[model samples]
Target: MLLTFAILLTTAVLLVSLSRRLGLGSVLGYLVGGALIGPAGLRLVTDVHDIAEFSELGVVMLLFLIGLEVRPRRLWVLRRAVFGLGSAQVAATGVAIAAILAAGGLAWPAATVLGAGLALSSTAIVLPMLAERDLLGAPAGRTAFAVLLFQDLAFVPLVAAVPLLAMGPSSHGLPTEVPWREVGLGCAVIAAILLGGRFLVRPVFRAIGGARTPEVFTALALLVVIGTATLASLAGLSTSLGAFLAGVLLSDSEYRHEIKSTIEPFEGLLLGLFFLSVGMAANLGLAVAEPGFFALALLGMIATKTLVAFLLARLAGQPDASALRVALSLCQGSEFSFVLFAAAVGVGALDQEAADRATLVIALSMAATPLLFAASERLVIPRLGRERPRVFDRIEDDGAPVIICGFGRVGQIVGRVLRMRGIAFTALEKDPAQLDVVRRFGEGVYYGDPTRHDLLRAAGAERARVLVVALDDMEEVLQVVDIARRNFPNLKLVVRARNRRHAYLLMDRGVGDLVRDTFHSSLRLSELVLRDLGIPEAEAGRAVALFRDYDERRLVESHAFYTDEKQLIQSNAQAAEELTELFAADQRRLESEAAARSRVGAGD
Candidate 1:
């Protein structure tokens, strides 16, 4: 086993590096590596079951990390997408695929199982791909995540339904009666796991955290993941489901980030291993025997799922480009298909021949996922998105005094303030939905990317008195700042900085009047907390003002060292010490003044 692992790791590193150079994803490399080393090729590792069991750990950790990132509040905000669009996509795709399979002369029960299984896309594959391309925060990525979240949640019931579906089985010797009592008990166990994880896991981690040892915290995190998975398995639920629940429970915890960082390496390595195992398990013999049939099935499944996904996304009101991207991304069969099919075969619901064929299609689809994303990028996105008109041809220069680049949260607030002050501004928003919303509110938000020089000019950037760069993305913010600096040099620029780093970069690029997006809000929150803790309102306000002034000064002082990590660290430490001393001196002076006033009142 150790020798096999050593060979696998070595092959994965080599192939993955080569794949990177070739611009193919690591998933493809892992798959190829697995195929080269598996029974289908050199047969270096024949006992796939052992490797599979070990690789399954990767999926568990992956789901756990995903859970940690997904806050309950965010989920609630995306409830419509998650429950509505997600549920609809799953049902529609499942039924569509099942009907197709039944038309091909498969049993309804088996077809239904396979159809639902194939409807679920490879979350493990799709998410990493989306994140790699920096689209996880985009509309398409969020929509995909919502749908995948629903699928993970739906897996439990789907597994349960398999046994019930197999009650009147044919070929394989299995139980013929549905176990209602066991099913009820399983549901009860799942509830118990959820309740216990919610109430139990946090306190356990909290207790371990007080130790302040990094290794201890890491151990405790793994323990929570493994323990929850074990409990779920015992309760007849998917282990990945338990891990996911545990993650969601810890999402809002202080230790969530730490836990994620610690477990990420393990998750990544294990996931790659799992993918490699998938490649190794490919039945080359079956493929060689029926090449045409296999090809047709693979293409058919991809087309079916992609069509279903695209239609569902469109029905849910996503734009053509986003819907197309979502469709292409999710058109593959998931890792869960293997589990479902294996279970189906164990229960005589599906035959061995059908299972092997389905598995082959799924594996091929998984391999095709990266290619699908590439196709979306190269072919779909550019051709289908909102056509770029001769930059801002729709905008009329109304002699607007100000030009706002973005119409998102920060931009909207800035627009509101400017409007309240009777200042005229032309807002350039890239998102059509945002443009429509602001237009409905009687604001002139144009639909165009402001980074384009012609669009900026059309938005009256040349005539505008001030150019407010209130875009959310730091890259866009920097781009707009550069364009304004070069083209509209006279326009006083008020740029929003995503963070201190962004502010430093903007400063380096010669932009003045920058607002750190959350800096003021954080100061205000701190002031409120100070006031709540019995400090006088005036005193609290003064402290906040002093702190803000000191921080701003520090920012300016440290701007020169931003390029050098070591210098930046030293400068930050020095600035922090100086601020602490300054605050302490101010506190002493305030106390002294209070004492003097009290003394004067006593004498009187």
Candidate 2:
């Protein structure tokens, strides 16, 4: 039976749109759509395995983007948790779960596989939720990252553990899928990737950096990720691990943001596909056959897992409320549980009957996670009855020289800098508690959603000469920009972009002074001047100002192309080839200017 690609494409798009409209995660949409057209459902999308293989490019892109940020220096900050907290969580959870299963009359091998499989929380689902909720700048975000970091590190051991556990006491005629040669080779290859990447990846990037074409860099980054994953697959290792390693390799590159920009669209599409595939693969008949038993199992798993996770996080010093939040967030099982269970059943480890039971529980738990997150934030947090830190959204304007949209770390820094310079500024913060702290120091920050058309006028948008988009939520930042630009078109709109996509979006909206939130541009300016020459500090300052102006001009000009995405991509191909040629010519001009300056300095 053959299916048209057009139908598959339409299903994917329809599922995604429906999910977003319903305020559900795209993951659910993809899975539901996949199930409908799957062999068991409509039977129209049986050849979806090929689609799965292609959609995996999204994961490769995801990892590549992560790698661009993995500098060795940053690891020092997380070294304590990454090794101590992370290791403890994986080891304790895996062994404890394994022991429980073994006591329940399961083979040690099968139990171990199940435990390791269950330990992983979904990385794909958590980050965006945190960022969207404005929790990324909080203590919980740091703790979440520490736990997620540990979970990512656990992948290697779990992959290795699966095979060993499957060979339990009874030689139950289970055909071993992992050949000795492949396992041994995979372990060796993992070592090679870690060791070789540190030395080789940086130099490779330097040679390519001057190329400056987004596509070439995107292609190269994807190759590294996919190639590593292919090797891991060949060696009987987890491909996701290979993808994660690809991210660690480029964790410190100059064009990191650009790399991120190239990967985002692909990641969104494939991640959606992966979710859809999960849905299509679910056995609805099994779910329906024993609804009561399945419901109990789902509750039991979610409850047990959430309790253990909460206790672990609390022991690590998070407050009880924060611990509970963490617990609810991770109660869900992930897509890979299917992969792990399939292997267990194929081998003589788990009986098909037991595997089906576990599969039903995993699916229900995943479906319940988003609901749990929403409930915790809306119901649980407010009920805890802890007083919020502060409220400052009611401050009156007094002809403040600057206006800030958010009172987060970056906004605070800007406000403090301006204050020291004897410049008055009015800030707006939606988080009442956060602004309460700023109020004590006589800082003025009003609370209101800037997206409201009237809120901009109330915030003195007409009088304020400068408007700063300091909000962490990219979507909210855009809304603020749109409102501010429309009402006060002459206002200076300085913005903090979450990443390249955010930056590009802002550029399209006529923002001339957009700064990468994660990247310290002022520091980068100094670093760039030092790299080019040890020019005097004052001279370096002037050059940076010139370069900043030039970059802003380029961003403004590029807005026309970016607004029309199709044209932007079409132009990217041609622009990529010419960048090297253009860069060389610019270098010659810079060199001549440097020489002329040298001659003048000598005369002086």
Candidate 3:
């Protein structure tokens, strides 16, 4: 048993690491690793059935964490996207696929089940993929999340309807009639969970917390998740759905962060295991046997789903680029399809051969998604670039003293201050949406990419006394800085560094007048915090100033070896220890001075 476990962990770590290194993502790595170690490959882990059941808890916990993030009010805020757009996408995609299957000589009942299953995209896959790229907050990412959430809610009824959709109960000997008793039980259990969560869970948490035992609190947290999931499972409900409800109930609780921290490790490991198990369960033999049919089905599914989702997004008033993103991100089949298909087979709704084929197709689609997304990012998005709503605004060469490269949050401030001083300046913003907002405020910011050499010259960069590179994108900022340095050598550069790395790059280009955008504000905030904590205002100011000076010096010193991880780590550690000693010595000197003053006063 331990050996099997060891092999699984070793394969997971090695493959997942390699995948991430290659920028393919950890989910795909897990799938590939599972495929390599499963019965079809090395024959090391043959009993996938047991492993699958255990790994399913990962899905439950993941949904729970998602629920914690989505408070009821926040869910309300996304009502339109969640219901309007989400429902539309599912219904359209499901019906379209179902119709195609029915036309392919399959029964309406079975085709409908397959279509619904295929229509649902993998929340597990999509969410992590979006988050890895830091796009979860973008319009398309948010839209994808809403659709996934709705699918989760929809999964319950879909699974329940499998038995109802059964033509005859041959294998399990199930009844064809509506299972009212089970339906009532599921509803009652749901109500119990909701009421208990509102009335009982928090108080129990309080008691456990009052006992001041962290281990006990952690156990209680796990118990809540497992217990609710078990209840839901017994009532023939999706365990993940139950866990999600529990998480949503506690979303507004003070202990939400603590609970999330406690459960995250368990969730991550199990989730990886779940994906691993899925890879192992994949029937590669069947796929290889009918490669042509498999390829056709896979392509058909992806194209159909993508087209349906894209059209829906466009109808919902999303911009073309964002609509494309939404479509591409969610074109794959869901993990829940495996469960739904298995249930369908048990109830004799779908044949075993059909389920196996669908499962492999779904898995392959999931495997293909990262590649598809990469193509979108690398090939498609650049061409579509901000949807290119209008041509670049022509610049009138007023030969203003200042040319602000980006009129974003930072550039707008510089422009505003210049305007207040009656100083003429030219501002350029690439995002049309942003430009529109600025225009509403009567700001004279032109919509143009500042990195364009022609646009820079048109903005009178050569004539302007100063050039401000306050663009959000660091690459753009550097480009503008370089343009100014090369073409307009006399122009004073005031650049914004998004982070330390960016600051280093700017420094490398011989621009010293750059600001680490958040550094000063962070220091000021820290000073305020120290004063609030009962430190004297002067003392707080001194502490902040001392740290600031030390950090600035370290930033310059570390810039030489910033690319070397070991040297950077060592430098940071040494700087921290030295700062601690400096603060200690300063404290001692203040105490000594206070003592001397007391002695002098006593003498007087």
Candidate 4:
């Protein structure tokens, strides 16, 4: 047993590392690793079935993490694409494939189920890959996410439908043939689980978490997931469905991150095992006997579905380029198709031969996914890019004297003030999604990472007289300051600090100009008005000027004090306060001496 565990662990680490080094996704590595170890090859994974069962924990945790991120507002944000583009893709593909199968002499019920099953794409596979490449929420990426989301939601009904559709015409009564009682009981059970997650599970986890032993928290969280999944299976719903709901239930918990982190290692190990079990179960003898059939099925599945995805995306109002992206993304049949097909066969929707064929088609497509997605950049994108984009192109730098790193609230106000005076300035941002939206809003911001020296040069960083680092990422902000101080040392730099702490850090890094907690400027202005309504305008101006200068000096002083945590806080808060008090006192003393000087001059 010890040897067996050691082998799996070593193989998993090796396969994953090698895959990443080759720029292939770890998912592909897991699948390939499984095939290499399973019966079809070395047969090292002798207990494939048992290992596969344990590996299912990966799927459970993955779904749980996915559920936590499923915010309603995000769904609402994608409303048009979710219902329109997504619904169109599934319905169109289902109908087209159903027609083809019906012509091939399958029953309407069977064909329809197969069509829907085949139409669904793997959200698990595609979504993360897109996100990792920083493509999620892009025009094309959002459309892909919308379609994937639709597929995940459709799983609920797909699972429910297999049993209900298999009921023949003679047993058409809702209770007997359709199993309404079971359906209702399932719904009630799911409802109870939802309520229990909110009222019972959250509080229970919180109490356990108070002990602060990560082991106890991890064990208890796993228990809740397994217990809920078991309850769901007993209620006659699919275990996957229960697993998804279990994730959704825990989404609101503060311990959501803890739950996810605890389960990730378990899930990764198990998912690897699951893929290996798939390899062991491949039935090479059958594949050899019908290699031609497998080839034909693979081609037909990808080609027909790609065309269907393309046509549906166009009909749903997507531009040609974005439509092409969707077409490629969903062209391959998903892993869930195997799960759905299995459910259909288990409930007598298809016979043994049919189940084997369905399984073969899914495996073949899954194998092809990596090649297809990789080839997409060269093969798919160029063909799609011939056509122009629908959106407007952003404005270029045009050799501006000033460039701002971020376009958030503070950045925007500064930008508007500069623009009002007709100052020549450029803006830079790293977020593709934000750039997509910001361009539409007519900000005309340049899309690039400011940290890259090349991008800085393109924005006229060398010739520019001033640069503002208003970006949110603190580490990135420091890097920008450091880079600017090196390359464009002549250019003046102004940065926004989140607090006095960040102010000191920025000052230490040699950024002379900074606005620390600048968001409070309005409140400070209001305080001045309340304190001395009858005070001269010049006096108020001098007071504001002194405060600003004192802040800059304090920030400079606090720089050397940060290495010690206790001194860090004292320098930032206590030191700043004491300095401010001394500054005010000195100002009053200077003003009194000036008044005396004026009186003496009048007497003379």
Candidate 5:
């Protein structure tokens, strides 16, 4: 088993790397790798069904992660798309396909099941396809996701109805009657998961989080998804649906990001395996034996679904290019259809021969989807005209002498001072909330992440005399520094450090003009306190200046041993002793000078 897995992984790595290098996506590579080592190819692993079942978990995890992003408010906002457009597309496509199949002399029940199954596009394929193109937040991508969400909701009922469609079942003995008990149990389980997600899940996560063991937290995250999925499966519901619900519930939780990060690798690996399994399960001989039939079926399915989806999207008020994109993105058959088809055959609603043929068509369509989208993107989308998606704001530069990366409090002050001096400067801020606030005050700051090289160049980093890294995020400051150093080698970096450690890190990174945000203010407060305690003004100023000089020197010295705790502590203690002695000596010198002046006055 291990040897077989080793072969699968090795094949995936090589093929995926080649595909990525060739500008084709990872999905294609996994599919081709699977085909190469599959039963129809080299026959490295024959039992594709087991692998398919296991890898289906990838789909569940994908949905869960997606759910984490789509919070309840966002989902509510998408209610129209999810219900109206999604339902219209599914119904219109299903009816059209079913009518065609019935006209071709297939039984109405089987045709209906096939059409419904096929009408539901592949969420597994479409989501990743859109993601690769960086379109997940675009109108077409959002619409596609909404439709897929509806399909997930529709899948359970579709599967449930399959048994009812089989009038006389000889194999596997599925009941013709609607199983009320099972249906009730499924609803009950869904409610339990929902309730648990609301009231129980967070508390459990909190307890586990309190333990401060990351592995255990990761394990619990997996357990939540798997456990919910298992319960849904036992209750005869869609496992992805259960996991999606769990994710949505936890979306607003503090732990969502951690859970997402933890589950993502497993999801990615298993998803690759799922694609591989699909490739392996493809019966290439059937396509080879009946070339004409195979080509006609494949073309017909994609064309019909694409047309129906495009029309529906248009009716839903989507623009021409976005509608076309939505259509092309989801023209393939779903992975869930495999389960539906298998159940249909088991219940005698569909023949094994028909199922095998449909399976091949679906697999091929999944493989072809990426190519189809790529072609449309390159050839068709440009012709239809492009509706530019919202991204980082375009920066307008007029040879600003200074480019401020962050437009928060520190950045705003810098901009204000520059404006007062009549110095031309450009400011960039990534935080939308901060940008909105700045705009209200009539500040001219372009919205963008300063860490991006493109945005930096657009903001006139090369022309600007100085690049200020005043971002609230310490990591972003470092990133800006690095980008400046690597890309614009001559650009000077004036960075603000949040603390001593941040200052030390900046020093290590070769940022010469570094200011600790609170250091000067703290020193001023200390000077004020000395004055309040009846110390002379000159003495107070001298004391503050003395401490400032000492600390600055100490900070630089400590940078060398910052990583070594013992050395840092020793240096800190030694600096404190030296500062005390210097203050004591200064006070004695003042007393001696006063005494000499008093004796001279007495002699006079």
Candidate 6:
């Protein structure tokens, strides 16, 4: 068992690394590694069933982590996309694919099953890729996520229907119809899980967490996941759904961050194994025997799914480019299709030969997805034409002395201060609504993302003496900083940092001056606290100044170790102790000086 595990890990690392270097995703690499080591190629491992079963944990964990990141409010905001657009995409794509299969001489019942499977895109594959490329916040990515959510919800009933479909029309004691009783049970189970998670899971975690033991907390987290999944399976629902619900329940919990960090490593490894199993299942021999047919099938599926997705996205009011991106990203078959097809074969709903062919098509489609996305990003979207310039671009540049990137709370204050000083500055903002509100009041806020080089240049970044970055997103801040440093080397940067970590990152990337967004206000609050505690205002201010100086110095000194977790933690602890001692010594010295002055005055 150890040997098999070792071989799998070694193969996964080497191939995944090579794939990454080749610009294909790690998923493709894992698939290739699986194929190379499985019965198809070198035959390193004979029994794939065991590996597949174990690898499913990866999918469960992936869903769990995704749930952790997804806030209920965000889901509510995306309700229209998740339900309306998602439902339409699934129904349309499934019906279209089913019609095609039926026309190709397959029975309607089997064809419907196949169509539903094919209509579903690989959420496991697509979501991670979108996240890796930092596109999840983009319109196309959000649309893809919405569709994936609905697909996951649909997986429960679809799996349930397989047995009924397999029973055929004349089976005794088995009605060939939708099982309403089972469906009701599944819904009840889902509701119970949600209610339990809301009322039960949080309190349990809180109790466990009060123990302050990491291992215990981790164990509880795993228990909750597995336990919920087990219950979900017993209730005739997908285990992934249960895990997802568990995650959503704890999404707003205080322990959410810790839970995510705990499970992330396990999730990555398991997900890799899952992909590897998928590769092992691929029937390359069949593909070789009917290359033309296999190629045509794969292409046709991709094209059909992409067309359906694109039309649905467009109908849902997405922009053409965004719709195209959504289509291209999700034009592949889902991992669930493998499970569904396998189950269908087991239940006699599908023939073995047909099942094998369908499995191969799904695998090939999954492999081609990353490449398809790349093509859309590099080739298709570019040809579609550049995005239209923002309203800010049409405005004339006055060659202002300063250019502020964002016009949120921080930017507004900065702009206000500059205006009060009679300093000419150009304020650029990305949000149309915010710009509209500010523009009505005759503020010079323009609608444009300053991270865009063209937009920055248009805003006279070249002529500006200073560029103020007040954007809330650290990624955008870093991008604008990089561009400004490269293109406008002479422009001084005054950035707003979200926190210590953000500040460290900015400083590491050569940002000279940055203000921790709320650090000064926090210090002011602390000063007021000291004043209220009977400390003189001047003394409180002096102490704050001293602490700030030491803190800044410590930040600079600790920047080198920031990337090393252990070293960073140790350094921070040591710095905190030193700061405490230093303040204590300073307080003692001040007290001594006051005492000496009082004694001298009394003697006089």
Candidate number achieving the greatest lDDT relative to the actual structure: 3
Please report, in order, the local distance difference test score of every candidate based on alpha carbons. Answer: 0.85, 0.70, 0.89, 0.74, 0.88, 0.86
**Count of steric clashes across candidates, in order:** 0, 17, 0, 3, 0, 0
Model 3 agreement with the true structure over 1-604: per-residue lDDT tens digits: 7887898899999999998888788888999999999988888898888888999999899999998878898899999999999899889999999999999999888899999999999988898888777667688889999999999999999998888887555566865477889889999999999999999998898888768799999999999899899999999898989999999998866567668878999999999999999899999998889999999999999999999999999998888888988999899999999889989999888998999999999999988898788678777887886542256899998989999988889999999899899999999998878999999999988888898789989999878899899999765676677667757899999899999988987887799998999999999999999999999999999999989998999899999999789989998899889999999999999899999999999999
Candidate 2 TM-score, true structure as reference:
0.64
Per-prediction CA RMSD (Å):
13.7, 12.6, 17.2, 11.4, 13.2, 13.7
Query: What TM-score, computed on C-alpha atoms, does each candidate reach?
Result: 0.66, 0.64, 0.65, 0.66, 0.69, 0.67
Candidate number with greatest TM-score: 5
Q: Which stretches of candidate 3 lie over 4 Å from their true place?
A: 167-176, 386-604
All candidates in order of TM-score, best leading = 5, 6, 1, 4, 3, 2
Worst 10 residues of 2 by lDDT: 386-395
Which 10-residue span in candidate 6 carries the lowest summed lDDT? Answer: 386-395
- Candidate 4: the clashing residue pairs are 34-276, 55-270, 58-267
> Candidate 5 residues 212-256, lDDT tens each?
888999999999999999999999788998999999999866566
lDDT of 4 by residue, 137-230 (tens): 5677878888877777777677788887777666545534666788898898889888888789888898997777888888887887777777
Looking at model 4, residue 579 earns an lDDT score of 70
Off by over 4 Å in 6: 167-181, 386-407, 411-604
Quantify how close model 6 is to the true structure by its C-alpha RMSD in Å. 13.7
Residue-by-residue lDDT tens digits, candidate 6, 537-596? 988998999999998898898888887899988988898899899999999999999999
What lDDT would candidate 1 get against the real structure?
0.85
